[model samples]
Target: MSPPKLVFYVTVVVFAGVVIFTRDLLYLVRTETRYGQLDQYDHAVRNKHHMDQANLKILRAKAGLVHDENNIELNLTLRFQVNGGENEVRQKLKYVDKTVKTSKKEAASQGEITFETPSLLTLFTTWSGKGDVNARTHNFTLRNWARLKPEVNPVLFIDDGYDATVAQRLGWKTHRIPKSSINGLPVLKDMFKVIKDTYKSTFYGYANSDILFTSNLVETLVHVYYDSFYSDNTTLVTGMRTNIVNLTEEEFSTQTTLLNAVSTRGQLYMTSAEDYFIYAAEYSWSDMPEFVVGLIAYDNWLVLNSRYREDHVIDASRTVTAAHHTVREPDYQSHFRENAQYNKVLFRKMMQFHVEPPYEKGFTNCIDKYTEFVDKKIEIRSRKLEDPCLF
Candidate 1:
């Protein structure tokens, strides 16, 4: 009886040991399988990330961007069609990670690539220092121009014995007028010629001293700088102004306040009266007439001449806010000033030489191209003008 009991107990103990061994073996297999699955998932995720990064690099390269591996920055290399279409500009830009995700979409939708950056431009002006209102308005506009600093270089053209202390202190370069009319008014052509000789900038411009510009001026120029329309041809950029009546220096103490006033209190001036003129540096002023500044006919004639030369003219009225403060009404008496009539005579003479009918050219309505915002992006579009004259 004792031998049989020993045998049964030995069999039960061996079966129990087998059972425990099999359970441990199954547990080891399940753990190995779980770890293998996790490893496969990690490899797939890493592969996807690598592929995305590679695609981003390819897209950036196609968009004229070179990525810096160490700093994660991008450098832009642009080929401009200025001065005979052979110039290249290289600029470094700070990169953002989100740019990688949207670059492809933007390139696809815009039909052209654009980058936001400060552009180099030169602006000049001449004003009389005769009245308190004139001084105040000039100071306000000059200060507004200051906000475009480090990007736009402003020059003040003064006649002999004119005070330029404020403009100099505000970082504007002061230059004596190269030539003036018999009445001591600066000649428009001479001012432009001096600017071309003195400054090296992507674009050059002249504005009435009372007109205030926002950063949109710089941004618009940057857009025009990259557009294919102006790539191969010299471009003349002009725009209408917003007339703000009795605007004071205190009304535009800050940029926000100024923009608010422009939107809420200002009225768009007639397109016939353009307050500013921006043109590429390549534009030629060789045959420009000796029309005087602060006069009406010169502005219109400048546009006419640019068009007659077959250069591109863009009306940037939609994108640029040129605020003109009406510190005082234009003197009707001054319209008959000898210097003022000088401009009109010059314009008529120019029209006669060009063999074009009078009153057919030299207005904002004659511009054949314009800059407009499409989906918050600047785009160049062709404008159809009625009664358009052939240059």
Candidate 2:
């Protein structure tokens, strides 16, 4: 190539890069602290200047959002993830998605993001009610969930371990449950049927249990997700995630299938490992939620969403926390031993919850975060329903 031609092309490319860099740099100046916290993240974080510039660019991609400051009230919906069979899991996912879009769109000038409550829609099983060995944990979880969102209708899938009294306490209706293997995971899709059969309301949400929210979390997300300004539909819900690397077919069975699919936004992002296993729960010989969530997406039962958030403790020793909530202290890690296999994946994923964060950061802190996250969701969901009066 001639020297003159080569020089001209080089100048054009460098100039373009500079223009892009300058715009993002200005953006970082606007939200530096927010982006700085995430700077360590490979996907979410970058230099404050870089992210500001990127967010600015992304905003510009939208037609009417270039410089709009209009405030809009978008509807907020809350739902839960149901682990069951292929058909059932798919059904619930569709229901939740439909609910979010249809119910929440009316109030948005831009739009609103629905904040999902994690256990709002758990699969009611009798492992706890059935008095089975595994029921011990299920019983605690079921009872707790029942207390959290009594308004959400329950379709009891397996009635083996739980009784009428327990069911009534949790405000669950008796469901004709499909027989399940003690060792198998439940289907996530079936929850859809229960919702359709019960609530005339189609809109709801899906969130995790262990999260707490900031005062502005639900409010902010609602505004942002629905904001006509934002073009991306799939929100990276989890700020932190514990990724899974080597998985037994069982562990990643359900998750791998779904996260591997294409979304409206294109590309199936594994929101986090939790959802993956959640898909494989059905037909699962082992009782694990991971497979249930993973498989549902893999089966194309649902779109692989980009957004996700972490609420629960993924690990016990790291001082780094999972959410922005208050916590009590836990010195338990000193006496507790971590599963070697678990730690390897956790460090790899760069997120460890439930487990203690770095030195001196322990259980109490997690408890605080949980308290805040849950309260935040309840507040947001309640306000959306116009019944903060209930609390």
Number of the top candidate by TM-score? Answer: 1
Q: Candidate 2's residue-wise lDDT over 270-302, tens digit each?
A: 122222111111121121122231121221112
Clash pairs (backbone) in predicted model 1: none
For each candidate in turn, the TM-score is 0.67, 0.31
In lDDT terms, which candidate is top? 1
lDDT against the true structure, each candidate: 0.66, 0.28
What lDDT tens digits, residue by residue, belong to model 1 across residues 168-191? 889898998888785778888788
RMSD of 2: 19.7
Clash count, candidate 1: 0
Provide the lDDT at 189 for model 1.
76
> Which segments of candidate 1 are over 4 A away from where they belong?
1-119, 130-133, 329-339, 353-357, 388-391
Q: After aligning candidate 1 to the native by TM-score, how far in Å is the CA of 55 from where it should be? A: 46
Residue 352 miss distance in model 2 (angstroms): 34
